[model samples]
Target chain A: MTPILIALTIGIPWLGAIIVWLMGDRREDLTHWVSILFSIGAAITSVLLLPNASQETALTIPIGGDFGDFTFVADGLGIFLSVIAAVIGSLAVIFSKSYMKGEGSLGRYYAFVLFFIGAMVGLVLSSNLLLIFLFWEITALCSYALISFHNDDPKAVKGGIKALIITSIGGVGLMVGALIVYAYTGSYDINNFLANYSTIPGNILALLAFGFLIAAAAKSAQFPFQTWLPDAMEAPSPISALIHAATMVNAGVYLLARFYPAFKDVPYWSEAVMIVGALSALLAAVMALVSNDLKRVLAYSTVSQLGYMVYAIGTGSVYASQFHLFSHSIFKALLFLSAGAVIHSIGTRNMLEMGGVGKKHPLVKWVFIIGALALAGLPILNGFWSKELILESGLKNGPLWLYIVMVFVAGLTALYTIRCVWLVFFGEPRSDYHAHAIGWEMIAALLPLAGAALVSWLAAGRFSVLLGEKSLPFHAIEPLPYKEMMHEILSLPTLVVMAVITAAILLWVFRKKLEGLINGLKSIRWAAENSFGFEAINNAIVKVTQSTAEALRVTQTGILNWNVFGILASVILLLAILVLGA
Target chain B: MNLPIPLVVLITILCLAGIGLYCLLITRNLIKVVIALQLIVKGAVLAFILAGNMTGQLNLAQSMALTVIVADTIVAVVGLALAVQIRLKTGSLDIKSLSSLKR
Candidate 1:
């Protein structure tokens, strides 16, 4: 049952992709409904896969050679992430019914969206490293295609290419690690590698561990690789909510958490992961605070929240990281969708033009506030509990200085969330832009996520059990009941973190009196606006790659004679070598 | 002038391949290129059989040759079809005219 359901979870979305593409733009309404229904079906299939989660491989195809068997395991981690991908994917598709209405190429948009959903599911479920890499690349491709969905817009195209190039570097890292593991063990089974990694020589093992770290950092947009995600805001809002916020970016944190038990003891690995997460959370929050574009602010916040998850994994608590992941997915998707609704109505993404929006779109205002509260990590919200859990674990296990840095970032999170919410939804109208009505489809998507953000912390009990020892044998996390989990969160450090967050919120309320401090901090603001010079570095890298490709282009004559002669020459070269060696 | 069967076959393979390569170097017609490709593939097929005979794996070699023939036919058919379309569109059989590299 689990195996068939796994097949359905991955297969259903791909089938929908093909169906939606074939449906064409002739009947755009039917295309919308077909995509929504197909995505909802996949969501249901993956959710059904949850209760039957086990350590056993749900399905395996015997490829029987150097690559080993193609395997899928319905483990706790895999099932939960798939459930997130499928569920949030369907919501994005439904929201697009209104968000993307009258938009050209609806068929192309829906096809790539569905394709990404299936690939995300496959990436998590597959235990074979090579299969995981393939799915990873497919998701990256879908992300690139969707990011530049408005292909004529040069900024959108540039954003898409940047995302593609950065993420492909990540793909190379993962492929190298997988190939190395295969070279040593002669199999691509992840479970086998995890179980017997010690057999590999220390130097090579360290190489694999660090290689995967680079892969995760690039994919998750951590530290130096964090620039592409903000540019990914060029995507349509539903795509941003589903791919950039809820699903795709989490793949990085998920990779780290999934392999925690294997690489935890590697010298300096956990510390490196900690510093990456800490730096990302700090830099992104500052950037989020300063951004004027509504979507870019949300993009930065998403990076910050992902940093918290990675930090939890670095502290050796996969459960805390995943719990935060679950919480973050709900709230961040809510925030982005509500932001989408606001943008879709205003026909502009500049927050300076969007003041007093709450007066017209009251439901959107309330829902946005709910998401904001979750983002700010205020009491009674899922983000509050999970974030405190991470901090608690970090203080106990991670270094003191990094914990202090993470706590400071939590306050910055509050400051930015409040600043973003106020700038877009509150104060007097900054401009005389006409506002359109919020669509029921947008409301339909926003309400469920808002409710989830409020109450998801109550599931702490079941979440732990699902990700506990039986499924993930290496990362032997134990189950914590709801009461105990709450008790664990309600500690002295939690109060301290809450105080920091409250102080940040209050600091915003009294910003008029802090002119001197604001002026003093102008340099920090300037740095944040400039992306702390990472954009310059990335642009230089892009220039280098383009020049290198241009230099190599002269060799491709495209004449058949030239190609054939080249092939002949290579063949002769090989024959000469063989004969000389003989 | 008596030659071993393997040596005779090897020389035949070389002659066939050399003619194909020489034609490919000079011809601009897409149809001739397809024909040249078939000649090269035929040489490859004979070489496979020759290797099989020496290695005593004639059956496997024959099966591989058959598979190559089926695939080679499709390549020829597609190439010729593309040539016909190119001719209709551009009114030239010269592959140089089809070069997208230059204006």
Candidate 2:
């Protein structure tokens, strides 16, 4: 039954692709309904399985006979993420109807989207390293296809290729780690590795830990490999909400959480993970602050948020990481889908062209405001509780200095969240360019996400238990009347920090009057815009690889008879050796 | 006891494999690559037959070899078709000219 269900997780979406293809491009109404039903069905299955998944029962299937088996434990970690993926994926599909209308190749688009949803489910559920890698690559494939869905545009094509190349590098790291584990343990099962990791040599285990680190960093868009994700904004908005913001990027954090038990003992691994997470969060926050493109800003914000999750895992707060993963998924999805609604109506992703949009699209305004408040970790929102939990975990479990850095990041997160909202919704109206009208599909998608963004934190206890047996130790601030639930988010220090940061950003946003006294860091701005010149470095590497391949191809003479003779000689030598041995 | 004809055929097969690898390394022409692949397949078939003779495994080696031959034929057929298409598109079979997939 477990094997059948596991197979269904991956197989169902791919099968849906077939049904979608059969429906044809002429019938989009049929296509949208099919996609909605398929994804919702997948989400329900994932939810039903969550309660059964806890610490006790894990599902397993032996694949490829004697090689290894695919194992999935519905443990705290996997089910939490599976729920996020399925739920967000269904919402994003529902949202796409208005966003995708009048767009070409609707059939192909939905097929790939549904296919990616299934792949993400498979990726999180797989406890076999090899199977995880397979699903990982498949998601990369889907991402590439979706990002480049508008094949006629060169920029979209370029974005897709860049995403493919960068993520494939992560795939290599994951494969290498898997092979290292297999070399030591004689099996590809993750549970077996986790169970017996202590028996492996320390140096070998450390290498495996570092290998997985590189894999996680690349997939989650930590520091160096993060440039690809912002560029991936060329994908349609619904795809961005589903793939980039909510689901696919979390694969790296999931991996780190999964292996933390084994790697926590290795020297410098957790430290390295924390440092990477901190730097990425801080750097991406700065990037988001400077970005004028609406989608690109959100893209950078996703990277920054992922950095916090990575840092939480590094700090040994597995619950903090998973909880943030849960909250980030809903709020970020809400934000992206709301942004999608705005972009769909305005037909522009540039914030420079958008202002006073909220007055006209009042529903969109309220929905987006809810998403933005949650993103800023404002009081009474789901993000406030989760981000506070993470920050508290960093203080208690992580180094003091690291907690300081995270607190600073929280302030920055608030500043930018306000900056984005103020610019898009509250500022003077920009020129009203041609735009698509908001539709029922858009409203249907955005409203529920906003609600989730508000209420999802109620599952905090359930999430903490799922992460491990240890109940989370959280400090509640008093004197607000409804102290246990609502007022717990606000206190003297939290309120002071929020008010101070919000004021600072307002000053910064309106700082033209104080421009003469402002810091003139032109070099920093230049560096951030150019991705710290990593583009040039990556291009150089691509050049060297291409040149090396060209140099090697000179040997392929392409002659028919000469090649025939070469093969003949090698076979004769091999046969002679075999016959002599016999 | 004398070795059978099959043993001699297998030895010849190894000689062909050696030649094929050499050609694959040394040749520059596109058509040569295709022919070398065929030689490798043929050598593989000959080795299988020889193994059958030693183990008294009747028809197993022959059928497996036949399968390789079939695969080789299919590959060759595809190669030839691609070559024809390339010649029409580029007016030459030179791989250097046809390396459009390069960055």
My TM-score estimates for the predictions, one after another, are: 0.93, 0.86
> Which has the greatest TM-score?
1
Model 1 lDDT at residue A476: 84
In candidate 1, position A338 carries an lDDT of 95
In model 1, what is the error at residue A61, expressed in angstroms?
A: 3.5
lDDT of 1 by residue, A473-531 (tens): 88788899977877887888999999999999999999999999999999999999999
Error of 2 at A20 (Å): 0.5
Compute the lDDT of residue A38 as modeled in candidate 1.
94
**Each prediction's DockQ?**
0.44, 0.18
| Runs of candidate 1 exceeding 4 Å displacement | A63-66, A560-565, A575-582, B22-39, B63-100
Please give the range of 10 consecutive residues that has the lowest summed lDDT in model 2 chain A: A471-480
The CAPRI-style docking tier of model 1 reads acceptable
